[model samples]
Target: SQFTLYADTSSRRPGFSKAAKPDLAVPLYEKFMARCRERGFQVEHGEFGADMQVDSRNDGPVTILFDTEGNL
Candidate 1:
C-alpha cells in the first residue's frame, strides 16, 4: 500500500479587496476520501486539533491545517 501526505497553503480569493484565506482542506479532504475508498484503505479523521495521522500504509495520510486567523 502506497500512502502519501500533502499540505498546501494559499491566499487566493477572487473579486475581493485583498487576498483571502483559501479553503485549503475541503478539496484535499474530498479527494483523499475518494481515493481511500477506491483503494480500499482504512481512512480516519483526526481529532479537531491533530495535524495528521496514518495507519498501515506505505504512504502517509493527507492532512491540511488551515490558519484562518492569519487571513489578511
Candidate 2:
C-alpha cells in the first residue's frame, strides 16, 4: 500500500503539483489502510514520503490505467 504521488505533465517532462498534499492525503490513506486491517488483511507498506527499493520476482501481472472518466 505505497501511496505514491500522482504526477502528470502535458509535455515530455513530469509535473507533480497535481497530487494531493501530504497533509490531506496521508490522513485519508491512513484511514483506508486502517479499514483494510479491520477487515483482517495482512497489510505491508512503506513510508509515505520516502524512497524505497522494491524487488519482485513474480511473473508478469496485468496492469491498467484510467482517468476520472474511467477510460484508459
Candidate 3:
C-alpha cells in the first residue's frame, strides 16, 4: 500500500534484438504481478513506456536495471 512500481516494457533477450517480439513479456509480467499479489504485495504503476524523473532521497543503495529502468 505504500510502495510504487515502475515496470519497464523493454524486453531484450540474449539471442534477441531490440526488434524482437515483445508479445510475451506483457503477459509474463502480468503473471508475475499475479504471483506477487498472491503473496500479498499491492501493485501500482505508471505509463508503461513513459520517461520518468525519480525524486527519491533514501540513504540505502538502490538497484537499477539493465535497461536503466525502474520498477518501484
Candidate 1 lDDT, 1-72, residue by residue in tens: 122233233443323334222365456666767799899887775442344555654465785455545664
Cα TM-score per model: 0.31, 0.62, 0.45
lDDT of 2 by residue, 1-72 (tens): 543647674545557788888899889888888999999997777788777777866576864343544344
Rate residue 51 of model 2 by lDDT. 77
The parts of candidate 1 lying over 4 Å away from their true place are: 1-22, 47-72
Alpha carbon lDDT of residue 25, candidate 3?
52
lDDT by residue (16-71, candidate 3, tens digit) is: 23432337555666677788989999977555445577676767788655562434
Per-model clash counts, in order, read: 2, 0, 1
C-alpha positional error of residue 22 in candidate 2 after TM-score superposition, expressed in Å: 0.9
lDDT of candidate 2? 0.71
Tell me the spans in candidate 2 whose CA falls farther than 4 Å from its real position.
3-5, 9-14, 57-60, 65-72
- Where is model 3 more than 4 Å wrong at Cα? 1-21, 61-72
